[model samples]
Target: MFVHLTSAANAPRIRRSGIRAAGRGVRGVHCFPVLPSYTLTHQWVRELARFGTRGGLVAVHFRLDDAEPVTVRHYGTPGERTTAAEAAGRLAAMEDPRGWEVFLPRSVAAPEVHRLRRPPQVAGWRYFPGAHGRRPCQCDGCRVRGEYGGRRLRERLPHPLDGPPPPTRVLLARLAAAGDPGDSAVLLDLLHWFGLRRRRRGPVAELARLAGHPDPQVRRRLVETVWRWSSPGAAELLDRLADDPHAQVREAVADAREWLAETD
Candidate 1:
């Protein structure tokens, strides 16, 4: 058995015409091969809600031949080729299966539709799986323009590589406040922000202070933060950190030199 979660509005039309593939290469339905845990089988309900489809969500149960061609992967990762039956077994063994999805290469016929019923609304993730407590990203690319409060939320936040850089004054104030308290995590985050947007000016003077901090992690973060730091003193700071007593900090200094070399 396999399941596809979609809007209730899609149900009647789907039953009459069958689930059709839309778009280019690797066209077909994105689904889950049924698992022993019922919630696990239809885990996409909550994420699907963000699309604002009419009449809420439903799970359409269907099946394809065991040997049918298919591909499976976690979101944002490349897919792997396998047969329908083998794909189910592969996903069943994943330690954390939350973000994985399966793709059937061909259309699901109307006759293959087995069951249609409501899927529990809260069964899956809202943005991405494992995102429950992390800060929500508010980048322009991530904003759903018509979503409730979407326009009101202009608060910028960091992602691994995206989102607007926070204001310099805000980051500087937080860094100054956290320095005395030795709040390593907050300091690391702020340093990382400096790493991404080097104004090539005043921030490097402030960044110089953290080079001698007790925590090697903080020093490593400083190395990462200053790669594009254009201040004349940057070379001296890198040299000082390159010989840091902690091996991990020294290792970071080694890697950061490559980035500095490229950018220079």
Candidate 2:
């Protein structure tokens, strides 16, 4: 499951920005692009229930940096329940389990997925002060003199490509069997792009597993990808790479380790 941390104002926009292989699915109830059905009231508690019933991948996009932090319940498969604090403690203890799940439309072959709806004209102004509502006042920055004509903005997933989501193992195998250096580079680039779009820890974790690739260049590139994703195990991965045999790989690892240390 993916957990995106963003401001409440931007949450709607972020939700609408579907991944590159865009597909349509409703959030929470029937996720198209795999976003959770969110509720401000008892938000975390509801998530726990959904996780139990849905029994698949889940994404929890929360705007929890408010004065009152959002409550989170221990999410589990069917028949398990726990307090929010307990759940938080458990999640915290676990290696950062990236909640984001990647799905390629053609690979997943979800017929239900459709093209994302087009956003309304001037919908971008919704966040500006005095940019909305049916009010008559001469604010210096009034985009709408009266009621806004634009349709209400809601999160939308991208149109799905035809097919089932590809298996991760298959993708990894393809990477291993890349026909040539160029093919391998392209595959790596695609996976890296996918990881960025999903914004989770799993892809980085998987990439870390390939750190021992015979190619120094590949290992060096992997360091940058891991650094960019900045997932839970990034520090550990860098620590392991600190003694890479190749000078270039070791240099990248050193830089990444320094960055992690400085940030921490």
Name the best candidate (by lDDT).
Answer: 1
Which lDDT values do the candidates have, in the order given? 0.81, 0.42
RMSD of each: 9.9, 20.5
**Global CA lDDT of candidate 1, please?**
0.81
> In candidate 1, which residue pairs clash?
none
As a whole number from 0 to 100, the lDDT of residue 251 in candidate 1 is: 91
Off by over 4 Å in 2: 1-183, 198-200, 228-232
What TM-score would every model get versus the actual structure?
0.58, 0.30
Model 1 C-alpha lDDT per residue in residues 66-115, reported as the tens digit of each score:
99889999988999999988999999988878989998878889999998
TM-score of model number 2: 0.30
* Candidate 2 C-alpha error for residue 188, in Å: 3.5
Quote the lDDT for 109 in model 1: 93
User: Which lDDT tens digits does candidate 2 get at residues 1-264?
Assistant: 223221234334334543223323412221211123332111222323322322222233322112222223222322223332443444445443223111222221222223322221222122322325744333223322233332221112222331234566766666667644435476565455444344435455656656777777777777766765557887688777878889998899878667767668
Q: In terms of TM-score, which candidate is strongest?
A: 1
